[model samples]
Target: MTATDGIRVVTLAGEIDHDTGDTLRHALDATGESCPRIVIDMGQVTFMDSSGINILIAAHRALSEAGGWLRLAAPARNVMRTIHIVGIDALIDCRETLSQALSD
Candidate 1:
């Protein structure tokens, strides 16, 4: 886990489903208190399910309510396609890379 500025960059690889969704949630929850921004680097993520989307949405909502932000970085094609199809891309900021996300 590399960080840029104050944002935590969690680089995730492999599938994001029910099994791994909890890990994502826990990670977000753990940082919710101190971090004002979270950047999930999905450049290596090959797959994502509805549960994974739900996790992201939950994290976004939690962070937003706390005056923070949750951004998605470098999602693979499949994940990006799902995000677009589900219209979550409009709710959360999705960038091409971690650098782009950090800059934003």
Candidate 2:
């Protein structure tokens, strides 16, 4: 993970599922004390399941309620489709590019 202009860019790869949910939950959210602005770089994420969706929703709600936000950037079609099917795209900003996500 890296930070750009006060926003965190977390680049995720491989698959996100029940097996990886705990680690991902911690990685996406390190400190609950501060409001966090983050962009998830999903260009390399190949698959995601309900566990992944739950983690994302938890992160989004935490960030939003704390005056911050979360964005999903450049997710693969499969991953993006999962997000769309679950309506997570409506709760978080989904961008087509990393540049757009950072700027937004």
TM per candidate comes to 0.92, 0.94
Write model 1 residue lDDT over 1-104, tens digit each, in one string: 77678787888999999999888788777343654788999999999999999999998998888888988999988889999999999999999888899885
Alpha carbon deviation, residue 86, candidate 1 (Å): 0.1
The superposed Cα distance between candidate 2 and the true structure at residue 26, in angstroms, equals 0.7
Candidate 1 yields a Cα-based lDDT of 0.87
Candidate 2 residue lDDT tens string, 17-94: 999998889888747657789999999999999999999999998888888999999999988888998999988999
Q: What do the candidate models score in CA lDDT, each in turn? A: 0.87, 0.90
TM-score of 2: 0.94
Worst 10 residues of 1 by lDDT: 27-36
TM-score of 1: 0.92
